[model samples]
Target: MEIIPSNGEIFLGKEQSFICKSSVEATMKWLSGDDDEEIEDELGRYKKELIDETTLTLQVTASKVEPDRIIKCQAETESGETTNTEIKIRIIQKPTFVKDVSVTKVFNADSDAKLPCAVEGIPTPQVTWFRNDMPVPLLPGHLSATRDGTLTISKIQLSDAGMYYCQAYIRERNEIEHKNVTVTVNAAPMVTFEEPFPKITSKSNASFTCSVTGHPKPEIVWKKGEEVVSDDGQKYILSSNGLQLSITDLAKDDEGNYTCYASNSLGQQSTTLTLEVIDAPRGVGAGVVAGIILLIILGTLLAVDLTCYRTRRRGFLMFLSTSILGRPAPRVKLEDDLKKGTSDKSHVVNISGIDA
Candidate 1:
């Protein structure tokens, strides 16, 4: 008798079979190593099948097989003599994770970070590391791996933050296992303004915006000089998220250097905003003042003309009244002078006539 396969190797959770062939017809039985008693056939796990009168097959299911176990097939003839052959079985198991990787890990900027992945399997599985789905090259100072499948990073930076994967591979089983971890690097607050403070006229609206980035989500504050700014609702309004500062009815006082401060647990940073406030153009202001002065001059001229006309009227009326009341005495004196000598004697008679 002879066994079809002399030796066999199979991975765990798989099936293997050994066949025995004899030249003459015989009763076939399956047995275990060095046992006088015949091996009983189990329904699905272990079974003995007769291919023909000269051939017999022994099938071992995945659950029934063990590493380094021997399976024997025996053929007994009608005369009660038995011939047997044996085959050795080797089992391989795929790698499996002992502990799951952490979903996320945080590290401060310029600090060190460690990531671990533990696995268990036969023949010692090999572990590899990857970042953002790309293979990580071995760098002496920056990145390295420990003997226990742990990845270490020195002087972590913002660029080093991303998805990291640990893969355990077993060549014998032709299987691979993966675990994912996300690394986050916390950095100091970085502040930036979209635009410089703009030039605005009085009673106009204006806004200042600042963009900030940090690991812990830094807080933003607006300040002018030494005083902190608050939302006044009517004139000064802060945005819902407090990233922008809005001003309505801008005035000359608002024109100055403004500061935007961003702070977090890591550190703080600030930026300056230069605001310029300009008045109306010189030509327009000069024109308005000149027009007011011209109107005042014209009004003064008109008042002077009305006063002179009233004065002239009053003087003419006084002269007319004096002429009418005192004219007869002067004419009478001139006529009397011419006839003074002759009228001396007649004066007495004329006085009497005048009385009459």
Candidate 2:
């Protein structure tokens, strides 16, 4: 007796048939597995048919058939002797997933990201990462796929945010299994103000604009010192797009630091702008007017004294002179002593026009 197929190879979830033929007419029977389980007609997913007196056929369809098993075809002759021919049957399972099929992952920009696609098959499935329906190129540590069905993207960028597929492929069977993965990358806001320190005169109008960049569109906010600034519509006004702030009638109190804050789902950033207000000229005070008047009075007295000394020899300064004893002014005349040969001089006292 001989089996039509020397060895049986069947794919999972598919039917395989084996034929047994004998040289002469004989009774045929089929058994399977190591325990020699008897094969009967129409047993579950297994079927047996007698094609002819010398030929027998067995059909088998099982969900799981792992390792390798033997299917034996037995033939009995009229001499009461039995002969058997066995064939090794192997089941090839198609690629299937053992991990979550629907996956969504979020990663911050410039950080590493991992996408998993765990699978199983008869011949260990090969994993590959795809984007936009194209296979992703291997980029050493930057972008690569591991043997354990993991896809790694190092230093992920903002452009890397998109839909990706982790696919498991069974090349021999041409079977594919893939999982859809949505990747999201978040970037922190970066805020910058062109004019960090701006100057404007007091009682004038001034404006400041901020330039911001980030993912998901950052929200703009303004603050002065530690307090949040609200638009009063008249004194403080914000642009319609909220990127600029205008102050009307700027005062010395509004000359502090103003901060432009930008925030998003990922992170926040802020920049400070110093507002310097120059005060306008003002009127003189009471103290300054009094000092000017005092300077004018002293200047007039000095001019009068100088004019009198040059014009009148006995002016106001000479009238205030007196003797040490508090007497009226005295007059004296100098006389040469030439009449005396010894060059000696004598003084004569005259009080109230009387010589003494």
TM-scores for every candidate against the unseen true structure: 0.56, 0.51
Question: Against the true structure, what is every candidate's RMSD?
Answer: 19.7, 17.7
lDDT of 1 by residue, 137-253 (tens): 879999999978989899988888889999989886678989889999999988888777677777778888998878788888889877898999987899987889998888788
lDDT of 2 by residue, 171-208 (tens): 98688888899998889988899999998889989999
Candidate 2 minimal-lDDT segment of 10 residues: 320-329
- lDDT for position 252 in model 1: 87
Let me know the TM-score candidate 1 reaches against the reference structure: 0.56
Candidate 2 error regions (>4 Å): 1-7, 13-24, 31-55, 61-65, 70-88, 109-111, 155-157, 192-217, 221-260, 271-356
Worst 10 residues of 1 by lDDT: 347-356
Which one is best on TM-score? 1
